[model samples]
Target: MNKSRFWVVGGEYTSTDFETLIQGTERVVGPFETRGDAERTWRVLSEDHRPQAQVRFTIAHEHLTMNA
Candidate 1:
């Protein structure tokens, strides 16, 4: 079986183009059990940094194998 995990990734980028992130400004939120949880965190992060035009955040997900 496989389980899905969610995370929030991204941070302040070097420019508005978002090609590269500024060193030391990268942020990785977590491996949330559900996408909804991850989204909630994402919203907070986005809103908190909304004033910064270069700051951004997005939700990401990955599947993990579960052993029985």
Candidate 2:
């Protein structure tokens, strides 16, 4: 079965919380089932990226689950 999932990737911006797509320092994380899921994940990422004023998060659907 296809186990591909979506992901959330963005950059660290100390300006505003907006859509930066593929800009600034690159950061990728996730294999979420839905965009909303990824967005939730982004929150954690944003917090981890603290010290910055603004942060951007994006959803990317192109990851496959690995089975062992």
Candidate 3:
């Protein structure tokens, strides 16, 4: 099985909002300081989380990704 990772940009959302966005669908990969930071973190997580079939998203970016 393989998973996927994504980073969101240009959005205004709180941590709770991000959590809700990814609720029950994926694992939050981080609480990044900024969208750019989340993007960088997503790259690292893509390698590890992708193989495990665990959806990964960044709370900072307010984006979600599921296995695909």
Candidate 4:
């Protein structure tokens, strides 16, 4: 059997330092099954935290697990 493992990654950066960073340092929430799931989490974080840096969420990577 093959299992799909997806991950979500986030990072923070402000306009003053936009060139230095592309994403947020904070991991909002992850390991969800689908993009929608990650998006939902990102939404919550966006609403809950109003940090000096902007938050960005993306599907970082996917891992394939094989089971015998």
Candidate 5:
């Protein structure tokens, strides 16, 4: 079976603060081999936390195509 995983990390404070931010989101998908890998993935998706900002949310997506 094929599976997908997602990790999100965001905080206006510091990287460590992202841990608390994760608690309010969906449960993290597993099969993560190492904490460093997981952290790296999360950092990629993380955004700055701005509660009072006019634009409170942001979304980003990317597609990669490779030739064999």
Candidate 6:
């Protein structure tokens, strides 16, 4: 069996191009059960960091194997 998980990943980047993230600025929000939950959190984080043009965040989805 398998289960889907969601996460919010990102933080301050080194530049506007967003090729690299600044040291110690990387952030991982979590393994949310649903995309909606992750999106809500993403919205808040994005809004809070809206003033920083170099800061960005996005939702990442992963599939995990579940053992019975």
Point out the higher-scoring one by TM-score: 1 or 2: 1
lDDT tens readout by residue for model 6, 1-68 = 99999999999999999999999999999989999999999999999999999999999999999999
The list of candidate 5 runs beyond 4 A from truth reads 1-27, 48-68
Q: Write the per-residue lDDT of candidate 3 for residues 1-68, one digit (tens) a residue.
A: 43333343222223433333333444455455466677776666655555443344443434444556
Report the Cα lDDT for residue 58, model 1: 90
Residue 21 CA error for candidate 3 (Å)?
12
Scored by lDDT, the top model is 6
Query: How many steric clashes between backbone atoms does each model show?
Result: 0, 0, 0, 5, 0, 0
Clashing pairs for model 4 are 11-23, 11-24, 11-25, 12-24, 12-25
Question: Ranking under lDDT, best-scoring first?
Answer: 6, 1, 2, 4, 3, 5
lDDT of candidate 2 over 1-68, digit per residue (tens): 35667787778664574545336588878678777888788778877777765656667787565766
> In order, what lDDT does every prediction score?
0.93, 0.71, 0.46, 0.61, 0.38, 0.97
Pairs with steric clashes in candidate 2: none
What is the RMSD of candidate 5?
A: 11.6
Q: Whole-model lDDT for model 3 versus the true structure? A: 0.46
What digit string (tens of lDDT, one per residue) describes model 1 on residues 1-68?
A: 99999989999998999889999999998999999999999999999999999998999889899999
Can you give the TM-score per candidate against the true fold? 0.92, 0.47, 0.34, 0.52, 0.29, 0.93
TM-score for candidate 5: 0.29
Pairs that collide in candidate 5 are none
Ranking by TM-score: 6, 1, 4, 2, 3, 5
